[model samples]
Target: MTPPPMITDRDRDVIERYADGATLQEIADGINLTRERVRQIVRKHGGADAETSRAARQAAKEAGEQRAQIEFLAEYEAIASNLAHQGFTRAETVSRISVLYPSIDVDVADEALRASNIVFDQNNDTDVFSNVALEAGVWFLLGSELRLKPDYAWAAVNLPQELLDELGTHLSEASVTPDELATVLGIIGAAQNAAMSDPTLTITGARYNELRSELLDAIGLKSATGTKPWPPTRQTLQKRYQGWSDALEAMGLATASLGRPKGLLAFSEDDYANAVIDFISAAAAAGAEPTFAFYGEWVKEQAADGTRRPSPASVRNFYDGWLPALRKANAVVAARSAEANLSVE
Candidate 1:
């Protein structure tokens, strides 16, 4: 026959402190008890065996870590899958993933594995998957119970296939084609170029560099190969322009006039309208725009002149003025293109 469990005064004290929201560490400190000893008492009184409690805590920690890993892997998979869908060359995908997930070395390894056609079979029947599934399932069930969203129920109820198909369809619609994205990128590049060229456009050097790099990347332009302080390469600029031109053609707009200097400045009615809409949408979503900062000897001069205080109005004005003009120009060009098409017809 099993011996009856011991009910010591220390056990009662630990339970009371736990009920009062004292953490295991805190409870241990208060009663001059070690954390392990306190944990033992709490488990015994709470109807858990010492071994069972240790296992439970270990399991919980493992589950948390696995969840985090899953989320990371899911994000990595998303980027790879998106690039694949967008018709990016495998090399391009690898290059882009390397830049995006620099910290996640697994991406680099996975890319190599994918390139080499080395496949590893995942054992679903293993303890890892079973623990992960149990934890994830519990979370989903609890969330569904609280929110009562039919979609969550559907996710939980359906076989993995149905869920996968639904997810795929959603992803497909959201996936941007390289050509389509390149056009939007082209416009942004033009805007950045205009900003950098205009003496009136007062932005921080860091912000300018960041925006310039982003624009270069969007158009598939490479940064300067060496450490020289020279301006961006002509070849890079040309490639970016080509990307933009391609995007313009894909959008059903005439590229002939837009491709020429001062071409974007002129527009037809339809083009003008579309440009206005696109500009407005882009401006509204311009939260991602980098902020420029000022420093160096100018900072001391400004401090001495009592002009060091940042002005919100100056920042707001830049966005308000430049974005509107770009939008109007784009619209005008679009409208003119439509008219030219009609004339040709």
Candidate 2:
């Protein structure tokens, strides 16, 4: 500014070197200035030229975003392809989507279809069975649903937009109707709930009962009691118990037994408790007086509290009422089978 600040020879030399393609280090060395100082000077004087650095930085950022988008699309495509192969209905796909992406927009199906790169023929039925695609579709759809849901907004924001578009397209082509999709979704949701409800014990009480019945039938036990004139000794009971135990073991159930002669058979605390109730009911229906003494040792082992074994009288009162009904049902079945055989002859 003061006389336009006399241009020093050193500055002129530095400028000349720079103009000749000398690097900032070379110019700094020539001017005896730090590289940083040289760069600052270059930038200050460069004016419009400084925009090159900013533009480069912006380009790098955009490239990163693009790469992310590409990756997301690839992943989504893979997942959609898998679900489509698995024969998952559209409703199942949507349900999986809702589960994975709760914040997904209601209109995602249309949007995804529009954005998908996958091509399908008009004749390509969505109902066409595909095990692999169905499985993969469920997972991708889950992700898509998560993307639109508010709760998954953060995930949606992080996901590349291209992926979202691709997923939308893939989902749109699914043949499964919305209602069918909902049922599948409900099933998946129920399974998840069941898993969460008891991570350690997945079998339900009803399932246990069915398994128990199957095991009993396998061991030739018409009922828990030996009333069918089958062997009733301790060894016979043990053999039957062992058979049931083996079967349950195969099914991964932990089993145990109690009782001496005509004693009560106990499973685990949970299983045994329920079995006892069932036994009492069965006894009442069978016209047999249920006796606690019949299961005295077993009950005592289960109680472990040293309470006196329940009296035979007490057992009879508890179970005597139900035996008659069961006996009648048994007689009816036997007679029907006999008549059927006679008719066949």
Candidate 3:
């Protein structure tokens, strides 16, 4: 049983406002709560029937429209300016913009770029970029810049190695270290996961270097997913993270250590709890039982859903925490009901 949220006088005022004809959305916007949460509170307090005034509804609509327009204009200007300096292929521009501003839809950006008559001057000098065959040794990454950077694409070259070597040096198990592979992939995954900024807070240099070093190791060792064992198209670290579980599992690599993921970024208690609750709620909504096994399977299931995935450590913490809390609450409620029945007799 989940415990109730602590409601103060401010919460009562929000309900009162909704009962007096303010929309649940308006109340939510004003009080910084989600509309669903506001609606739940209003319903619990018998305020669901109240309809907001037409004027208030119009005002809310206008506010939303205005905010959207402002956002669109800002996004358009930014993309147009970027296209002017970093003139790239249409697809590359789209990918670059998407990586930089993750919230911006690729299609929407593409349409806007076309409509704005913004043309990208192709990188004519990329012809100077020759394909260098990556030897099976550790490669060093000197900078923090990632795949989106203009120079980043040139850092690690994926050359043609279709001609299998009799020595089996390329794409061979003798050269692959599963533990090292897991560690590097974990770090690269963590890098892409942490590397985003616009909407995300910045991480520390120490953390950044740690991730960079692992990526450097992969690049140096030619152990990166696409360049080494995996397909060449699996070039970006993002690709590896996208195929994190599957690729590792397919290679018969152990993921038990990846579960702890301390080599990655730091996650807070609130973040962990939220991830746990999200999994439980989503599972329940899907009509699936929220067991450890169910969540474990869900986590391993293929596809990058862009959700804040929990670690094995997080799963254990959730199991040890929420289950006991739920049972204790249930026991308290049962005891209270029993006491009330006895008093009535």
Q: Rate the local accuracy (lDDT) of all candidates.
A: 0.40, 0.39, 0.44
In model 1, the worst 10-residue window by lDDT is 223-232
lDDT of 2 by residue, 62-93 (tens): 67655654544454555543443232333444
lDDT of 3 by residue, 1-345 (tens): 966666779778977676555777878889899999887876665544644544555676667655654565575666654543332455677777678778876666665555543434343322211222111110112113333222222221211223123213433443645544433333333332232211122323233335433543455433422122221212222133344333222222223324332222466544555555556666778887455456666665522565556665564544332232223233444677799999999
TM-score: model 2 vs. ground truth:
0.22
User: Model 1, 45-160: lDDT tens per residue?
Assistant: 67444455456667766676666556655566556544433333345565677677676555443544354321121222122222212222222222222332233222332223
Q: Which stretches of candidate 1 lie over 4 Å from their true place?
A: 1-33, 36-40, 43-47, 82-345
Cα shift from native, residue 220, model 2 (Å)? 46
Ranking by lDDT: 3, 1, 2
Deviating ranges (above 4 Å) for candidate 3: 1-12, 15-62, 75-78, 81-95, 103-345
Off by over 4 Å in 2: 1-41, 44-59, 79-345
Looking at candidate 3, what is the lDDT of residue 171?
32
- Candidate 2: worst 10 consecutive residues by lDDT? 224-233
